[model samples]
Target: MKSGDAARLMGWDTTRLSRILRGTYRVSADDVRTFCGKLGVDDPAGVEEVARVAEEPIGEGWWAAYASRIGQNYLDFIELEAEAQTLRIQHPVIVPGLLQSPGYVREMITRAPTAVSPAHAEMLVSIRLARQAVLSTATKLHALVPESALHAKFESGPAIMRDQIRKLLDASQMTNVELQLLPLTAHPTYGSIGAITVLSYKHPWANVASVDNALGGNHIDDPQQVSFLEKEFAAIAEIALPVDKSREVLDEYLEGLRK
Candidate 1:
């Protein structure tokens, strides 16, 4: 069968589906389930094989402990980041991973639940910094930050926060990275629904979105769920500040902090 037809049968776009097959994208547990259902495979061993291959290991040591725990969904998320043409993120709490300053990330990890070991947190930080590689590539990134995130200082202290803001300013200068501030006054909007990120991979058959949740930090790729998040993101973006205005607002906040 043609690749497009294969993707349609599996409920994914041809390019993305092919990328998964080619080891360019990570296959998620959900994707494995779908593949099994479509291909009439009864055993899960095949699925596990696919998952293992998709998540190519990097480096050695403690991260290996969590390696098996990193399921297909996580791999798929990495793949989407790799292939995405445009990334739209709305974060209400901490800064999004791609834009996070190392100091800010360190502070957040230190305060995380005791269930997460320091070694694991360090590994996660390493992964996050690696993810930033995509921002320098051809992808177009649009990030929406609530004013509260700017004011919320981390455990790293005020100096770290100052440096973080400066880092943000530096990132804002990138033409491909469009940063916007959703003002505190612009309250009572659709965004009260919670944090969401939409990754759009432009494929020949159709675009795909990977949506993320706040509480559990689960990634959802189901078409219905992705569609709903997309609409909600559009509504929230509409109420957010335009690019130029948002930049001005960010600068004003930085200036106030310097005073």
Candidate 2:
């Protein structure tokens, strides 16, 4: 099967299917029934679950405080990230946002073409940093970053890269964190596709993949597409350095940056 056949079978692009599965779509009982049949499951109760999610008013989350500052696309990720038990990430460009230092994050935001106002940028930074709270919680995070991302110098400049590398090293020490470095030779295959974060929860909710691009991207929950992305991620991880070796790679890069 080609990469997008599952989306074709689902009769929608992965992004739209993702919205439906993520409950962002106006999920009618009829739609739910149809999906249940398609998935070969009997799930009228699933329709009711969708109905509840649609009509039930939600209380304020901490992100609510920065809703204006945080873009809706990221807010969507935040919503799912909060409930996820595990976060498996493939970062090809830079450090994953959750693991980024405040300075690094600020540099990233300020460099954006949209050019946020000073105060507005600070609010967004707070939300981004606040997201690190998930790290201290029960969420188990696994990040596979290529050596190039470690080597990539951004507007935050050398200092931030060093700080970021130090942070990556520190995070690798965390019991719940699994950080690996994909070598340059692996770039043509796994790393070239850029970043994707797979979030796992308990059953029925299943897994969601948030595919990132130059612009913000969509949240996907289609079973087959999620499975495909998972396999792709696994392939990348396979080529990546093991834990100790990943650290060794990091040390080598960090030392190179110092010289």
Candidate 3:
């Protein structure tokens, strides 16, 4: 069937449908269900698969109850992350979401004002860990962490911090992953305002930026924003410690936990 015809059947605008087909915009769970119903996809498994790839794995029962209420951008980020070839993450206060250990994630969520229940927190951790699959893939990961983040302790306590640092050490050992530390003595610059992550795809056409905010986050796809983020990332990488030195730093931190 023609693209326009399929779009019309699904009740989507032709241009929007084209973008989804081209992978420029993410297809949401709702979109998947709508398409399945319109296209006469009756099998339950078929409908579930369509929604599964498009949505974040929120486990079985909970996602169905609250899927429509969540932020669309978060769902889009999940899809973008899955397709990334290279990920450049700059973290100031907390660890990068993908690199965060399960204990750390649980601590953060439980400490929040609207604290998540134990089950929900576990689900979130599962999602975060699943996101790490990209790191194991052929994707190249570059993570720049401010020295302060290393010093800050989560509710998980010193042991958790040590384990988390050890995980970072292991990840850095991988040829595809480079973890850099921006020491506390470093001068402030443009990227100091907030955390940022830039994901570059092997396809050349799929570059994106996840810009941070005090209240929430924003995804940047405009060429100008993407170019600016790329430049900032380059500068941060240049000023941060080299991979070997960064690993040494992490080791030192872990040792201090024992003292």
Give all candidates' CA lDDT scores.
0.72, 0.79, 0.77
- TM-score for all models, in order of appearance: 0.69, 0.74, 0.72
Give a tens-digit lDDT track for model 1, residues 29-71. Answer: 6677777678776767666655554465643433344556556
**Regions of candidate 3 where Cα sits further than 4 Å from its true position:** 1-69, 214-216, 257-259
TM-score: which is higher, 1 or 2? 2
Model 2 lDDT per residue over 38-133, tens place: 666766666556545555456477877666755688888888898799999987777789888777888887777887688887877888888889
Tens-digit lDDT string for candidate 3 (1-259)? 7888998897788999989978778899888888878878777766775677678543353234335644566656776777788899997777787777777766666677776677776666666677777887898989997777777666556877777787788888899988898887788773576888898864325489998763447989898989998898899889899988888888888788422
TM-score of candidate 2 versus the correct structure, residues matched by position = 0.74
Q: After aligning candidate 1 to the native by TM-score, how far in Å is the CA of 256 from where it should be? A: 2.2
Which runs of model 2 end up more than 4 angstroms from their true locations? 1-57, 154-157, 256-259
Query: What value does the lDDT take at residue 139 in candidate 2?
Result: 94
Worst 10 residues of 3 by lDDT: 57-66
Residue 132 in model 1: lDDT: 84
The residue pairs found clashing in candidate 2 are: none
